[model samples]
Each structure stands twice: as C-alpha cells, then as structure tokens.
Target: MDYIGHIKLVNGQVPSESLLLDEANIAASRRVDLHVQTHDDPVLKLCLWDQAASEFWKKFRASGGTARVVLVTTLNPKRYGVLSLSSMTPSRVFLDGDIQETRDYLGWLSLNQDVANRLNADVVVKPEPATLGELFSYMKRASAKVAWFECTAAIDNVVHGSKWYYIGCGDCHPKATKGPTTLLCRKCGKSEVVGVAQYLAKLSVYDHNDQAFFVLLGDAGEELTGKKAAELVESYYEANDGVGDDDIVPVPQVLIDTIGQTRTFIVKISTHNLDGKTQTLTVTKVLPLEAPAPKVKSGDEVDVELCNEREDLADESVKRAADGVGSEDAKRARCG
Candidate 1:
C-alpha cells in the first residue's frame, strides 16, 4: 500500500489553514498531497489524520523544503468531492533519499524536473479562513467563480418570513417553478419536472470580526439541525391535515434550537459575492460547535456598525428568496 508521487504543495505552514475537518465535523489526522504518472495525473489530496499530517510536515521541514519527490506507505483511499488518500494508523513517509524506492523516484524527478516544478495552487491548496470583513474586500477583485472559507460564527436568529425550504427538481435538485400541471426546472430545461422539498434556511450569523447572514441550504442545514427539510415539511402536513401541500411551513424547532449555538461553517462565495450582487455567504458545510470553534457564542450582541451596510442587502435577498423569485443562484435551492 505505497503511493509515490511528486509533492506539489504542503499546507499547515501557517496558523489559519492548519486544521482540516471532515464532513462529520470531526478533526482528522495528517496528510501530504501528491500526483502520480510522472506528475501528469490529477491532483490527489492526501489527508493525514491525528499525528500523520503533523509528522509529514515535520519530515518535510527537516528536508529543508528541498524534497519534492516523496513516497508514503499505507494510504487509505477516500473520495470526498475529489479523490484523496488518508494515512492509516501504521502509515509512514519517505523523503527523496530516505530509502532505495525514494532514491529511484528522485532520479525520475531529476530527469523530469520541468514536470515536478509546475504548481497549481487551486489543485494543491485547500481554502483558508476568511473573516466577514475580508470577504467584503473580495467583492472588488475578480476572483474565482466560487471560493470557500472557514468561518467560526454564532447564529443570531433564524430569519423569519424567509422561505425555509425550496421546491426543487426531484431529479437534479434545482429549484423548480410552477407550471400549469407540473414543475418547471429551468436549469435542467425540463418542462415537466417532479418537485421535492429541500432545505434553504437563512440565519443572521456573526463573528468577532463581523456579522453577516448565512444561507443554510441543503445538507448543511441537515447537518446543523439533525433533520431533513423534506421530512420536516412532510411531518408538518401530516399534523395539519387540512392544510394544502404547498403551504409554507415556519422554521422548525430543530433549526431554531441552533439560534444560540456557535459553530464553524464552510462558507462558499459565488459569482454573486464576487460581482457585488450580494454579500450573503452560502453555507455548504457545517461543523460542530466546540472549544476551538467560534469565539462569539450564540445570541451575543455584536458591534452595530459592522452590520449596518450588509443588513439591507441581506434583508432584500431574504425577501426575494421567500417569494421563490430570487436570482437563479437560488441553487441558494443551494447556498451550493
């Protein structure tokens, strides 16, 4: 179970980007990333858990950062949006001259230095933490179509009157609009679409640095509340039998229960944020609240001036979302 490849980038050199959390919100072990096939293969994210990640860095640093070629033993293959390798408990690392295998790999790298020297930040590095104020600065810059960041913030309140769920295309999950006798999925260009309920809640969240609104959409909402929007909507109709199926259900108790809790959010900035169309950072992933998470706790009164400018925009977006008539990015039938 050995993986040998050219080391493209090594993270954890700084304080902000050091930690990596899995979808379940648990801290993972160490990792060292690489690409194979003479560095022509797609980038592979090597995630090392526990001490594995730290240990790799320790070895890399000891090599004076001159070691580009690497070989590691015992990697557990994993898939999370992309292919990755997780170092197992017995996993170990080897630098350029650590052993015969690594020496041979170094020989290959020496001959293919041109390929080994190429760097793709997008492929090698994970997103770093950004503050609410910092995200605002990116509005003026032409950045990536979508960018992600880690933010620790407290949920101020669930935005009432905002549509808590969206009616999405049953197949592709894009928001579906009503047609004469069927649902219309413009994204999929399907005239006759089946509809399904999906989570799209809005929250007034704040960090010590700034306060902004977070759109809790899809699985992120499910992660926070431990309930699915579909099931919640279904249970509501079941209790209120006389009500129509299309009625808007208020934010459920499970969601509201999160109002006073502080948690870490993996925030996604879309074209809307980059182009100054909106300031709302969509929550794609939610992390559990713990000691090392957000500095501000739930229901804390943040600085009034920090939120003044962003408030109007957030309210307008919420209104548009409540009516199911916002920008097509309402795949914020996303907060993707």
Candidate 2:
C-alpha cells in the first residue's frame, strides 16, 4: 500500500547492513524506524529496510531533518508487537523534493512545535501559511510544528478579562471610597484616593478552519483600544459621578471596532500536561501582525505611514508611563 504522511521521528539504521555481500541484499539489511502521520492515523510507525532506508536518510539529511513530508510507496502491513508498516524491496520514498503532498506536509509540520524544535537549527526555513485549525492541531501536541511561527487571523470577538483599574485610598489601598475631596479606604481605614490601572485583554481570533484565544497585555491592549486604562476609568467617572461595586463598565468603543478585522501575530504555542493523562494547548501573545512588504513603492506614502505609526506608538508609550505615576494625583485633583 502507498501512503502519504509526514515523518515525525527517524531512528538509526539496524546493525550488520554494511557486512552484506550482495548489493541488493546489503541495501535490504539497512533499516530505520520512522514515525509518520498519515491521513488515517495521527501517528504511525514505518520500518524501511535496505535501499529505501539508505535513500530516505540522504533526503532527510538534505532537508536538514526539517523536510518531514514523504510518500511511501510499496509497504506491507505486518504485526511487530502491534500493527506497523514494513518497506518492500520495490518500495520508493519521495521527500519534499518533487511531490506536492510532501510540500504541503512540510507546511503542516511547521505548525508542530515539538517536531520543529527537534529539527536541526541549520535548516533556517519559514513555515508555510496555515489556517487556524491547522495551527490548533499543531499546538494540541506536546510541541509546535515550528519554533516561533506566525499566523494571520481575524478578530472573531473580544473577551473582557481583568478589571480596567482599582480605585481606592490614595496610599493605603488601591481601591477606596470616593468622597467630596478625599477618598476613604475601608480596608485601610483611611481617607485619600489613588487610582491604579490594570489592563489584561483576551481576544478570540480565527481563520477559515477554526478559532483560538490570545492574551494581550497592557501595552498591547492600549495600542489596540487607543485608550489608556486610566483614560477608560476617567471616561467612566465622567459619565457617572459614582460607580458602585457591582456596576459593569462597557468596553471601549475602539476595542469593540476590532472585531472582524484581520491581523498577523507572532505566536508562542505550548501544551501543558495535566495529571500525566491530559494535555491542552496554550496559545498566547496578541500583538499587531507584521509581514514583509511585497515591493517598495516609488512614493513616500509607505515611509510616511510607518514613521507616523512609530511616532504615535512612541508618544503613547511616554504618555502611559507618565500616567502610571501621575494618574492618582490627577484623579484627586479632578475630584477635589
């Protein structure tokens, strides 16, 4: 039977093949255990003997062990402790060299972190484009298809995660009660107000195949929402003079607009083992996606846009830093 699969693991040749006299028989003596994944099985083992093993090894090395794509033609299904694939004398193996399926498999392998990390670093190749479903599959395993892979996804929805900020006693407690001129910290039993900002955002992003969740930190959230945490709180206060403990604040309008927009992002994917039996993929890092430009335009519009974006970011960074320290004082002044 012929099978199209991606090589997951490759073992060293069996001993005594170099001692054979006949060329064909000597070739048959060389054997390698290959762990491959076919369309039917998520993982399957194949034993390549003699000539097939020798030729496959050369191609695997040439691909720097990253060329995981392969097509095994002419193999027998046999029981060796369990069901496995055995190579025949006439079996032929093709690497990523000329087969389209092999090329597609290479892209698929890029999404598997474990497979990608085990590959030789000298390969220095980028993964092929993949859908959200493919990315999730790669992450579901113990590792990723490739180290430091990127994905392009559309914002399916925005999830409200942590509190925007805590308003409390100016010095004793971050969350406090606001009076006419002074703040009261019930926990600290003091009267002074200070505001501390906490920004944690979670976004559900997807491509055609499926969806996954990503976490965004303060800076990333601010960039996406176009408003600082302090600003969001201030806006809330302006609309309603008093906020109760149970009052729910709405998300910033800017952030709401991000739903359905496409962006590219660098992802750090991992899996966590639970109780030695179950594992789950942890997908993180939500930031603006960046890719190489196809060609430089003759005009300065591209340059201007880049410069403006950078300048805005720089300005926001400085503003947020200042707000972090002075926001409490500003709030006190406004209330006083």
Candidate 3:
C-alpha cells in the first residue's frame, strides 16, 4: 500500500546492511523512523531503508532539521509484537508540495505543541509562593531574581478574547495562517500542514489588592479544562457529526466552570517585554487549595517579633486597668 505522510523525525547515521539480518535490526536497520500524523486523527511510524533512507537523510541534514517531506511508498506491515511499517521497492516521495493532505499535515505539525511536549517531556520543578501582585512587581523590578512563583488567587473571569482553543501548526505549534489552503508556520516558514488543537486559556486572577493576567498552556490548560483539547475537539465533532473543520469548537463547560474559582498555581513570569511591557504570567501547574506546602516555623525571627509585640501590649493594658481600679478604691476609703 502507498503510505503518504509527514516526516516528523530523521535519525542519524545508517549502520552497515549486515545489521539488518541480526536481531539488532531493532536497533540497527539504520532505519529512519518517520513519525507521520494523518490529517484526520492517528499518528503512525514509518521506517525507510536503502535509497529512500539516503535521500531523506540527505534532505533532512540540508534543511537544518526543519525539512518536511511526504512519502508515497509501498510499506511492509510487520507485527513484531506491534504493527510497524517499512519501506519497500517502487516507493516515491514528495517534498513541500501543494497537495492538500501534505498541506494539512504541515499545518498540524507547525502548531502541534502537545505533540512536541510529548516528544520532549522534561520535568520542571514548581516555584516559590507569591501573589499575583508580587509576580507583576517582580517582573518590573530591575533586580528581580526568581524565575517562577507559586500563587493562590480567585480566577476573576475567563477572558474570551476570541475562542478558548487555537489552531496551531504541528511543527512549531505556533498559530498558523488561517483561511489558506495550506497551513503556514510563520516561525519555521513551512506550509501544507494540519492544525493541532491546543488550549490558549487566558485568565484574569486577583488577590485582595491586585489582578493580573495568567495564561494556562497545554497540560496546564487541560488541567484547568478537566479535558484534553484533542478530546474536546473530538467530542465536538462526534456530536456535530458533519461540521466543517473551519468551524470553531465550543468552549468546554468545565473550562467555563473555572470562573470565580480559587486554585493554587505555579507560574513563570516573563521578564522581557512583549508587545509593550514585560510583565506576563504563564501558569505551569494547577494545584488544589489544600496542596502540601513547606511549613513556616513559628521560631522564625519575624514571627517571634510579632508574637512578642502583641504580648507586651497586652501586659501594659492589663496593668493600666489594675492601677485605675486601685486609685478608685483608695478615693472611696478617704471619702468614708
């Protein structure tokens, strides 16, 4: 069967052909694993060898890792525990074409940040506690040192600047060109791709004295929405059945329900100016109000001084009342 899809990755250095006969074929085969996501739903892995391998490897290296190609090749579907596809003779390939499927896949690749995140999952430790006001103030201060801040505040409202979800390029996952036959990623300058659904939830949250805009991206957005953007998009299509791809997916009710709710979050504040000012907050983690936090010891100097000051004032007030009562009693005895 002719398998046509995007080349998501091109691995390095082909091993000798003899490695193909050994069990090491799993590791050798000098195989190039092409992560291909279809325009509709499923993402598949395709392996290339021989001429196909040499051509793809050459172009991939030439493009500085941004090269995308569509392959129309006969594939051997093998089931070594899992179903896999490998290139066979009589295969063909296309690069950066005007084909609609190629265009759709490219669009998807450019905006597929979730796909990128899954491909590159690295743990980021949550930051220290702060207020929304403090987060903004930190960004403004010339000597600000912290990179991330943990904050608790009431979500004043969910800002509907446009739609809650955005159609982004699968490759770089940035917002893509709309109303065009092919998706275009401005950053990568690639076209003919599909759009991936991702959350772009902007929230207005505030403490007692101040309010700031906080953005929840990808998993953080999914956490706030209580469902993945892909899941929500799929559900919308299942319900609407024949809706056009250009039609917008409605905001999930779960996301809507977050309004006026209080949640603790770890956010990274942007220090550099964007658009005009530098104070921007991005939520990295959504935690429950009762989430475990480090205990502040009562013996800390600040706490100790506050306790001492309250106790001293209490003692002085009691002594003044006692003296007033004794003087009144002495005056009453003198009068008698």
Candidate 4:
C-alpha cells in the first residue's frame, strides 16, 4: 500500500537538535520518523528505517527540502500508544514529482498550504531517559505500549550459559532452528536456509538501586563491543577447529571486558515486557562511553563495589579453555 501525505517533518534535519539516533553504523542504518498529515489520518507518523530513511533524506536534500507531499510504499501498520506506519526492507520513499500520486498531491497541497501549516510537527515521540525501576513500573500500567527510553546503567554482569549468538536466516536474520538436514526459519517458513551467526548476548545492568536484564539483540552487540558477532564466532571456531555443532560458544572476552563500564542504552519496551512473558529489556542502542551518562536520580544510587554478588556471578563462567571449561568435556558436562 502507498501512503500519500503532506510531509510535516523529517527527523535529523531539525536545527539545534543533534537527534541523530546513534544506534547503528549510522551511515548504513539511518532512521527517519515522518510526521505526515493525510486524509482520514491527521497525526500519522511513518518510520523510515535503513535504506528507506537514507534515500528519503538524499532526495529531500536534492529538492532543497521543498518536497511537501510524500508517497511511501509497503509500510507495516502498527499501533504503539500511537498509530504509526513502520517501513520494512522492501519499503520505498517517493516525493513531489518522483511519483504521479506525489505530484498530484503536491499540486493539491499548494492550494491548501494552510491545512499542512496547521499541523504541529513537534508531536513526534522522542525516547525519554528512564531508570530501570521506572521502565518496569510502566510495564505494569494498562496504558503501556511499545516505546523507547534511554537508561544509563553500570554493567554488573555478563549473563552466562545463554547462547551468545544464534544462527540466523542469512536473508532476514531471524533465528533458525535445527532441521533434519539444515537450519530452518519458521518466520520465513522455509527449509535449508542460509545460516549465519548473529548476536543475542545478555547483560545484567543496574541503575541506582534498580537492576534489570538487558539483551543485546542484532547489531546492538557489535556497536557496544566494537567487533562483529560473526567475526568473534568465526575466531572461536578457527581456534577450536572441530567443535561439535551442538557445542555453544562461551561469552567472548570482548563482551566480558565491558563488565565494569557504564553506558547509556536505548531500550525498546513492548507487550513482551507488559505481559510478563519477560521483563528483560531489549537494548536497541548504546551511547558512547565518553558521552555524559544520564544522571541517576537522587537517593537511588547503587554502589557496584559493594555488590560483590554481581561480580561473582559474572566470573562464575569465565571463558577458561585452559581448565577445559570450554572444551568438549565441558560441553558434555553441561548436558549431563
């Protein structure tokens, strides 16, 4: 379906706001939230992600930012506290004369420019900074829906035993399960899929007196560790030449090195947290260490030094091949 509307705003172009979502390799993965006003939908926000986002901005710049009417194709309709349209990989953005609909809409917009002018473009939702306690509290509320928040927390522990990375369908990146012969992706409903390792690392994070689990999904791990999950997995396999397919790689030292560091994370919350299926926060982005961390609210500061239990839990499963902990014998031990 094509969404034709008057483009009210495109994020990252707003002045005095360094609102660049520093979540991904940015250049390759940019996000543009479109404040569009259309017939029947007054405050529709179209989220252009990855390719769609970068290209839209390119065309917007080429047009001297005068392109008012936008025509976006293949948007996935969603409601997350607000009605929103999110673009997928196949989505494309068109503006002004680029498409017949946009051209016609632009002509119509020129006649009723005041209608577009009446819309408040500043209604876009920006991620608010929240503490772990506050985030979980929101989960219990009946009104909680999909939302993003920035949380500054100290790395208390790197979770152990959980699979650090799962073999994902190479095309879509969904986790693939072991099939009769090859890995299968249920989401794609296919067999013999292309399998590639992707990050699914876990960390125990704490802010003030609130502690919560944060799962680094997709490229979030790579952004924090400064190394690709595939590279780390390949290095491990090369070192241990013939490890069994069933044998899982232990948490890499690169991730462990972040144990005591403090970083601000952009976490996304949804029904997964609200329904109590899991309270684990899915980390979408990590702010650079040099950037000032969000201030922990007064009377809620947690002293990690005094939390000896967290340190102990992190070191319990240190990647120790010398002790045969990560060896074939260790793998068998875990099953037993």
Candidate 5:
C-alpha cells in the first residue's frame, strides 16, 4: 500500500469552526517527522478530513514543504464547491464520488493520460449519477492502474486498474440550436448550403474584408473578337475625345448576349472632371491583319466555278464548327 495517511479531526487545535484545522495541525506536526524519519527524503503522505481541505491542500502544496499532499474527500456537492473554488492551482484534487456516476471526470483524466500519469498527488471526487457513467467510460480507456484506499460499496464499478478519480466539473456544455446556419465550421471543414445568402451578404458588407468580386456569365458574342473589339473601342474613345486613359467600360448587362460571343466588350467612358457623365462605346475593330492573303500564280488560274464552290464549302464548314459538331468525314460526305 502507498502509505495512506489520514488527517483526522481533533479538538482544541484551533477555532472550532475553522475547517481542516485538525488536518492542518497534523500536517504541521508531522513536517519534522516527514523530513527526518521518512528516509530523510521528506515525502509525507497527507490527506484531508475537513471542509477546509481544498484551501489546506492549496496552502500545503504552495508552501514548498517536504510533504506530498493527497486529498481524499467524498464526491458530495459540498466537496465540489470547495474544489471548484481552488481549482486554478496545478495540484491534483480527488473526489470520493461514486465511480459510476462521476465518469465525466474520469473521461477527462483518461483522455489526458500523459498528464494524469505524471501527477504526484491524489485528487479525489464524489460521483453523481452523471459522473458514474462518465467515470466508467473513462476507465475503459485509461491504460494506468489507479490505486485508492477506503473503497466504498457505492463505487464498486472502479476496477483494479483504474487511475483517475473524479476531480470536479471544469465547465458546462453549450446549448444546441435548431439547425446549422454557418457555411463553415472553424473546427472542421464541413459546409452547409442554407447559409449561402448570409455568407454573401457578409462578404458584400463594407467591413467584410473581402475585396474581389466577379460575375461569371454565359458565353457572349463580343468575347469571340476581343482584340478587334478592344481596338474599335480605343478608336471610338479617341474620336470622341473621351478621357485620355485606355480605361474601357464594361458592356451593359443587356448587351452581354449579343457582344460576348464576338469577343467585343462595351464600356461606358467618362471622366470625373467632365460633369460626371459617361457614354457607351462598342469597340468592334482590332489591329489590322498583316499579309491578308497568299498571292496566287498568274498562270495557275483556278476555275471560277471551283472558286465559288470552295467559298460555299468554307462558309458551311464555319457554320458546322460553330454548332460544335464538325468532323472531316461528315463534311466530305455531305453537300451544302
């Protein structure tokens, strides 16, 4: 057995109402014995027997004395009150709560196995109905053997190899909502679709911090001839003596279907100094093509009928290609 020392109650040691006064006195009296007789190593085993147990343990641990402190208290509501008040210190506080009822504390300790194993002192707890289940769940997972003295029948569920006794509750659980309304979970990457509108609203707000905005539209006729359209817009701007910069305004939304496919964009051009007014310009011509065609030999005159038929074939080919189904075999096998 790991020397179970009891801080029993005694009379006249201090004021009658002072909780843990007897335990404190016993601890004080045994300080010298613990230093000199405990193999000169100064490790005295101390336990609590009073309401002031939490305070006494905190002071004893903080005093840098020669004793190793252990708290053995029932997991009653009163014990929880005391432990919760003194919980900020690093020392272990145990509860004599029912092992089955105090499973949550056990679960916490079991989850933090490495920290629990290295603890130098005992922290006891009194288990409630909820705690018993939590503790059993925890014990099922813990790898170390938790030893205890004065085992009671109420907590027979604690097996031989259990390590964590209940300490106390740290915090309460948060409330649940009717449904998830957020797009992303900060904890996980899960996404929800219902909050898309809210997310977009948040993004559009001035303080939203997102700067980029884009509109993806179906293919536009103007887009097919981007270079030609751009040059045409530039010439129009120059001819109109609009603002000097080459800032082309986007085409009106209504014209997107007509101009997008032609690679031609429409923009409204205006200058702030010019009465804050703007005019739309359609840029339809691009840089002139160089070497428009290959010269044919004068003697190698192609037949007129052949030339006309070739032009018709070429136009038909272009139409078929635009329809997204142009095969060489189909063209060869068909007559326009």
Candidate 6:
C-alpha cells in the first residue's frame, strides 16, 4: 500500500459564532473517511469541539466507526480539574506543557513503548507559530505509520499532503505563493482558509475590576538569581531599620560584584494598576570597602609644644643662670 500524508482540516473561526459548524458538516459528508491527527501523533486522529463534536460522534457511531477523539491544549493543572466536570470521554488525551513537552510526547508515540500506542488517534493542540517549523521537520523524519493534523488559525500555513483536505470558509485556502489572486483552492475548492483575526480581537477584552499584576521579565536571568538579589536587598533594608529611600547606603564592592557576576540578577520592582499600566523601579547600587588607616610607631604620642617654651631648654646660659638647679658637671667640680 502506498503511504499517504496526514490531512489537516482547520476551523479558523469559532464555531459558536460563525457558520463553521454548517461548513464542517458539509465537508464531513463529502469525506466520510476523514480522520483527525495531531502533529505529535503517530496516526491520524479526530478533534472534538462545541456542537459539531456531538454530531460527528453520532454520525460515526451510526456508521459503525470507532469514536477517536484527541484533546490537545495547554497542560494546565486546572485543565484536569475542568475535565472532572465534563462528561465527555475521549479515547485518550495527550498532555503537553509547551513546545518542549511536544517533543517528549511525540517521542513516546514514535517508540510505541507507552500508553500512546493504545490510543485510537493522537492530536497536538494549541501550537504556536514559532514551533510550526520544528513540527514539520519532525513529521518528515518520523518512521512510524501515522498521519498528522494542524489546528491553526492561519490555514494558509498548511503544507500540501496527499490526504490533505481543506475544511472551513471558502477563503480559508492556502495562499498562492505568488500570482493573480484566485479564490479557488489549487487542490480543491470545497473548503478554504478564512480570516478570523477580527473575531479573536474582540475576545481579548478583560474586566478591569479583577485585574492582576504581572511582571514580565525581559532578558533577565533565572528565578534563583532574582530571588537572591531580592534577598540581599531585603537584608540591607532590614539591617538599616528605617533608612529613607534617598539615603546613600554604602554597600561592599565585593558583595555588589558577586551579585553582578550572576547574569540572571536584574532587580526590578513594579506596581500595577487595573488599567493595565505598570510602574517599575530598578535598583542599581554599587557598594565599596572602607579605606585602610596609615601605619604608626608603637606607644608613640604626638604632642605639639610651643617654640617659646623649648627655647630655654636649648640655651646653655639660661640653664646655668637658674637659681634652684645647676648643671651636673658644675656641681661635681664644686664638691671636689
């Protein structure tokens, strides 16, 4: 049997608000053998979402087809919490954290060494545009007998594949490399890629009353490094008791240099408003060591005496003319 590349049918716009469900139903009717699979899956799989998911399952059951649903999304701990609330049963849900997690997830599938082998289908979910290149590369290198699917908001990004089918809006087809614009899909005109950016923009709004402050790190080092810096600053603040903000506290250069050596230690203090604006204060201080004292003689006392008082001690006549005291040589001669 000849190998067939995986097919990706994207619903670029939300099915709840748009005619995506009606369009998907039409496509499904035409290609009854359609299977869904994620990029990480070794085989094609199905995706379940909104109202069409129920209808698709019903049709599959009626046709004696096995229900294979793949759930791909962010690996939030809360996702499991929400799953407990939902009654939907998927063949298996592959959990991935990020692009890095996708690598491990695919590895397990490719090896056929784990639970992934038992799943009816696998689907990769919530892929970012940056990782698309890596995903395509992995697909090309895989030796497993599997198919792939892409759930992208931008359907024009899909590569051509043997089993590929376009599903969604008429305009949702892949963009021509270059030429006079053609509305018809080069492979098939039944479905095409569409623009859904406008609708997505509306859902970006949030309530201002329940705003949360988030500090985004830009070119900053590791969490440990930041924590160390914060600890050092906290120590300084605590040791000084109540130093004013404007006070110039001398910090040891050795400590400052040691902290600076850590590439990840950028100190950023910030406050956020419900309006989505942030005020940030950066802490930059250099501490230096104290100056050393000059060396001096032991038990030496430096006294400043008047020049006039020292003149009498220096003159020989002033010493001999003194009434009470005489020179030691004169006293010995008079006694002999």
- Estimate every model's Cα lDDT from 0 to 1: 0.65, 0.53, 0.56, 0.69, 0.24, 0.26
The candidate that wins on lDDT is: 4
Ranking by lDDT: 4, 1, 3, 2, 6, 5
- Please state every model's RMSD to the true fold in angstroms: 16.0, 18.9, 25.0, 14.2, 34.1, 35.5
The TM-score, computed over Cα atoms with residue i paired to residue i, of candidate 5 is 0.13
Q: Give the C-alpha miss distance for residue 226 in model 1, angstroms.
A: 0.8
The sequence of per-residue lDDT tens digits that candidate 2 reaches over residues 1-336 is 997776656652211223212335435668767766654344556888888888886676565555656788999985422356889999999987568777787677667656534544222123345566655565555423223345677776655533433443335423456688876666556655564543444466777777666544444556556666668866777888778745756656666667776766554332221112112122223344455455556875453232100111122232333233322221111111
Report how far off residue 223 is in candidate 1 (Å): 0.9
Model 6 per-residue lDDT tens digits across residues 194-232:
311100000000121221111112111113123232334
lDDT of 4: 0.69
Instruction: Quote the lDDT for 16 in model 4.
Output: 20
**lDDT: worst 10-residue window of model 2:** 327-336
Instruction: For candidate 3, write residues 1-336 as lDDT tens digits.
Output: 767655444432222222222225523555566656444335455667766665655555455555554655677875321245778766655554446666666677678756533432132323557777666665666645325567888776565424556666776665667645777766567766677876666666778988866666656776665677777887889999788977767657677667767788877644332222434466666874453445567676232222100111112222222222322211011111
Per-model clash counts, in order, read: 10, 20, 25, 0, 49, 14
User: Global CA lDDT of candidate 5, please?
Assistant: 0.24
Q: How accurate is candidate 6 locally (lDDT)?
A: 0.26
Residue 24, model 6, lDDT: 64
Off by over 4 Å in 1: 1-125, 142-145, 189-191, 289-336
Best by TM-score: 4
lDDT of 4 by residue, 1-336 (tens): 668888767652331233333334445557777778785356677888889888787787677666677888899987554567889899888888997888888888788867867756345444677889888888888867667788899887776665777677787776778888888877668888988877777777787789877777767787789888889988988899889767889889888877877788877775556776667777767776563445566698843331100111111111221122122221111111
Candidate 1, residues 1-336, lDDT tens digits: the string is 678887765552211133332323322423444443335666666666656656666666676665666677898875432346778888787777888888898888888867765654434334567777776675566534445677778777676654688777787776778998888987669999877877788787777878887787667888898788889998998899888766778778888777767788887776567667667767777875443333454578443322100111233343456334333231211121
Model 2's lDDT to the true fold? Answer: 0.53
